[model samples]
Target: MADFFRLNKVLIFGVGLIGGSFAAALKAAGAVDEVVGFGRSLPGLEEALRLGLIDRIGESVAAEAPDADLVLLATPVGGMAVLMQALAPHLGPQTIVTDGGSTKHDVVANAYAAFGERVGQFVPAHPIAGAENSGPAAARADLYRDRKVVVTPLPENSSVAVARVCDAWRACGAVLHTLTPADHDRVFAAVSHLPHLLSFALVHDLAVRDDRDMFFTFAASGFRDFTRIAASHPEMWRDICLANRAALLDELDRYTAQLATLREALASGDGAALEAAFDSARTARRAWAEGKLV
Candidate 1:
């Protein structure tokens, strides 16, 4: 059989970093014939066209999706409802729809709402590769190389559709892992989402302090590294936080309990208790850093 990824046309709903990089990678690999971008911003679309990331730009996914063999939604998780509604009527029987949403549960719910029994056509995926920078200008063909792309296939999803999505990502040089939507959201909440929230909170807390300037002046590499994610697109993170609120809140509670334990240790001047807690965390982090856990 011919490769399903070698498509006649691929529609990218949001032609920014993730979408643009995907287009570039697939085009370079000869896995797609023509890539068309659909989005609200014409200027951004034009820039992507100029950068050779897309062959054309259209205003309506409903208008453009009918001809597409594949539709890649790279917009924020919050945009899923709109995108799904627009493309619902136009998706061909054989067309494969996938997304780059960081959180899967909400997007999967949106797909079920839009496509109903045909939700199997929409495969929910999250690419672990992300950059502090965004937009079409930051796109690179190698973005997914050696990176993990997690696919959380819904029960309604067809095996064929899931396999095709996996093969496509593999062709783009991504390592594929399969998980349930709940598992994907829970894992990401604990690891990615929680860290980002903490980073933003820390930066915001420091910013409002009376000695913010003085504190910043004395800050070093550790602070910079920890807070780097705070520079991420605020709107995107906001949407993610809301969409994955349940899982995130669970993680926050667990984290807060840990903090409370540490605070108790510090307040009681229990150096040994503090040392034990710190040592356990340090050892776990060191193991992960050495790729023993990851």
Candidate 2:
């Protein structure tokens, strides 16, 4: 099938890892003629250009957005509303607006508030890809390859706009899946957000211990692997946790209950119960890793 949208320019609202990687991937595929990045840091945007991730720096969303056929808001979830409002008047009817946000409900709400009847052009997406490292320097053209990009189109979204966003991700070698904004938040809250919070909590716990230096000195591969996500950008995760607060809190409560059960088992010397719990988790993880479950 032919490409859905051939872009003259793709305006990126943040020139960090996600935005830089998107620009690099699309530029490498020849899907976009130019990638203009709008960001707070001129030096950072310049660095992205120097690395060839973007073609130019955008001085203002009002000025840059008018010329862009597609605008990818790769900013943090908290910043989406402001950026959407800023771009509202500048966006043309033909321009498609999409975002790379971890949480969608708030972003979709921002879209409606900014564009109203023109919300059809706004398609919300969340790319299930990233690394512990961030910034333009950490961007990779193949970051989205084989990664899942979830598209949660609002009711007012035009089919053309949704398809164009899906096609753009596909062009970057990402697999696409569609879900409602609520469903996306619910699933990711349990799988992604909860784990990240656990990781952060674990690290924070260790960091406050009296033997903290000793703990770090002896920390092994297991600790490193388990705490990797804790190293991610704090402000970004903070916004996501708050944006999907209800779902995240529900998942957190369930996880805490499980931990309490395990703790009781350990304290009561209930070896059989502990063994059964461990075995169940081990079996389930094995099945997931072996692709028996999707």
Q: TM-scores across all candidates?
A: 0.95, 0.92
Residues 1-294, model 1: lDDT tens digits: 236557788899888899999999988888889999987788889999999999988766667777777889999888879889888888888898999999998998899999987888999999999886788999998999999999999877888898877877777889999999999999999999999999999999999999899999999999999999999888888999999999999999999999999999999999999999989989999999999973
lDDT of residue 227 for candidate 1? 93
Cα lDDT of all candidates, in order?
0.89, 0.90
Candidate 2 lDDT over residue span 150-193, tens digit each: 99988888888888898899889999999999999999999899
Best by TM-score: 1
For model 1 the TM-score comes to 0.95
Q: Point out the worst 10-residue segment of candidate 1 by lDDT.
A: 1-10
* Angstrom error at residue 108, model 1: 1.0
